[model samples]
Target: MKVTLERNHLLKSLGHVHRVVERRNTYPILANVLMSATGDGLDLRATDLDIEVTETVPAMTATPGTTTVPAHTLYEIVRKLSDGADVVLETDGNDQMLISSGRSRFHLACLNPDGFPDLKSGAFTHTFAIKVQTLKDLIERTQFAISNEETRYYLNGIFVHTVDGPDGVVMRAVATDGHRLARVEAEAPQGSAGMPGIIIPRKTVAEVLKLLDGVEDEVKVELSDTKIRFTLGGVILLSKLIEGSFPDYERVTPKNNDKALVVDRDSLARAVDRVSTIASERGGKAVKLALTPGQLELSVTNPDHGTANEELAVEFDLEGFEIGFNARYLLEIIAQIRTENATFMFNDAGSPTLVREDGETKALFVLMPMRV
Candidate 1:
């Protein structure tokens, strides 16, 4: 395609889609981004079979056409160009795309646009609009708990659905990796009622987070049984939904954990970090939390490393008990808490522990204890 675009604008658009291009692809066209130039602007599309991202940038069309070029290579070239420089992209007859900016020039091998796979978007059965910050909050609160194990494919994404929350209906996002679970809910937005539950894959969630990083505008979401689409500003992301049933997460959440301990979130997180420093480096080392009337002690021991112990004043009325937990898990959950105190509810030393912000019911974290 023959078009001239500002260097920064072209680079930003390329950054959005190039991430979806697979580094090693069986099909040559899959490694390239489809660039189409029209009188209005330039359209850039990239995909990795399961997910597709498209971005549009205003450009001056010299000779309107379409071509496919290496996504990463083109991005790197544009990124290195001087700021504010006008970038010119045109196809040469010898199956190559020429990129020029000021004194810099590069020729990249091009593929036929026809060879690029079409990103199939199914008709959406449900469509909703949500505030960018609300969606981002749901992801940040639970995404850390998504499983990385390939065998349990269903656990590799956040389970999103409508739930009867404490305050009327709300949209809930839950994720668990068997060791720890995170559940966060937000007030349901307009047109979200009766939407079917969907599992958004980890990769797609990452991409969506990137798109909404600094954006505060509302994002339009369209979904079907097998596909999901997100439109924000001038960008469009379409992803295939994971076709598996998520576990019944409600059953895993402890219902009657009575023992309560309230500790400053920062203090607890710092204590865990300090104690875990001397913990075993192999498996996520376990930290022992000893809770008494109004004091909590965190301790860790490793054969190779030394031992660490820290005491923090907390608000606990339960009888003294000790529980073992993965230090890393505690830190991750603590990072999600935005309030001053992190409340912990425990049934026993061997049972799962429930954690949440003090006096907050919209977000909760459950962590399975580890044997010390």
Candidate 2:
């Protein structure tokens, strides 16, 4: 294979595909990226068994052929090259690939392209197109709540499905880590009415977000029972779905919490953060929220570090009640609120608390209280 491309184009294409390659791999071919040079362009593909990404870069092709080389090595070499330099790639019959740019040159061992594995995307049952901003919103709002525990494999991803919403059909994303839950929705795209629920793995979610960053174009989605494919311009990402079923998150959403407490989102977050400074990290950084008619007191106590306290004015309908929660969790939820004020609906000190933007219902959060 022989191809010559601009350094910037090569670096951008390599940046997109090299991330799929793991630093450590049991199989030799899995550690390399497959490069195919044709009259159309130069195609680069990399995979780590579970996920695969491919991108095409425009280049001057002298000899059309295919070969495989270390993904990260090539990416790093190209990244260090001077800007605007022309990069040349050539393969000899001796099973080696040569990379040259100005005064720099590297000869990397190559593997047979025939050995590269392919993740076959079977016939897709559903195909839909979603606005870039809408998809980005759904993911950013709920991705932080995805569980990292390996035992509950089903909770390691975001649950996505379409349902009949108040204003019509809407697509919703839900994620929970047992301690906290986030749910957000957007208007459903055309042809997504009866789509099956799917759990997109955390890694895939992250990759999709990167591809969507700063992009104004729409994303094309095609999915089957076990596989999902996302196409963004010249880049394609395919990932295997989690086979297990996600927990029934709707049942846990509290609906009867009546006591309303409204507080400035930024003010409450700062107060909680300040008071938790002396909180013991091993003790969950628990912050106590003592709500009175017109004021809220935030306090944290640690036997080893002493105590910290802060007060904030708040609007509460009920008399006196105190609740304990992880300060980190509280701040994370508050950061997602788009409005200036956040409303908390409390049932009791022991029950779960519901939080939302002052008057908006499109996004909601449920936080489990901790025992202080």
Candidate 3:
């Protein structure tokens, strides 16, 4: 196989798909990217058994053929080459791929393209198009809550589905890690009302986010019972659905928490950061929040580090109450709030707390209190 492509174009295409290649692979071919050169352009494909990404870039095809080369190694070589330089790729009889730039050349071992796993494209039961910004918002607001634990595999990704909102049907994304939960809603795209709820794995969510970054055009999404595909620009991403049921998240969202405390998001985040400095070094030290009529005081105590406290004025008129929370968890949720004010609804010191932006009901957070 032989092809010539602009340095920037080759680098961009490789960058998009190389991330899907797993660093540690038991199979040799799984670590390489399959490259197919045609008269039109070049096709690059990479996969990690579960998720696969393919991208096509315009190139000058010298000879229409196919070969496989190490994804990361080739990407790094192309990245270091002088910008705007034309890169030539060809495979020799010795089963090695030759890479050449203006004044540099390298040969990498090539594997037979026949060993590369074929990604089966199945019929999609549902298909729709969504605005890039809307989908990006849903992911950015909730992805941080996805669980990293492997035992509870169901909680390892964001739950995406359609739900009834105040105005009408809307697309919602929810994620929880047992300690904190985040839910964000956006208007459902046309013809997506009957889409089946799917659990998008954590790694797939990350890849999708990266693909959506800075993309203003609409993204096409197709889904089936066992697989999902996203197509945007010149790239197509196919991922296997997580074969597990997510928990009933609505049951855990408190509906009877009456006490309300409205405070500036930045102010509360800063206070939490200051007080947690003296907190336990192990678990992000628990910080105690004492709420009164118009004042909120945050304090932390650690036998080995010392103690710290900070006070901030807030809009609370309920009876005084104190609650304990992990400092790191609190900051993570607060960082998602874009509005100036954040509202917290609490039932008691031991019960889970509900948080939201002051006047927005489209997004909500539930955080379980910690014992100080």
Off by over 4 Å in 1: none
TM-scores for all candidates: the values are: 0.98, 0.99, 0.98
RMSD after Cα superposition, model 2: 0.9
lDDT of each: 0.92, 0.93, 0.92
lDDT of 1 at 371: 82
Best model number under lDDT: 2
> What TM-score does prediction 3 earn?
0.98
By TM-score, how accurate is candidate 1? 0.98
Q: 175-291 in candidate 2: lDDT tens per residue?
A: 999999999999999988888899999999999999887467699999887989999878999999998898989899999999999999999988888898889989999999999
Q: Candidate 1: minimum summed lDDT over ten consecutive residues — where? A: 277-286
Model 3 is weakest, by summed lDDT over 10 consecutive residues, at 276-285
Distance from true position, residue 64, model 3, in Å? 0.6
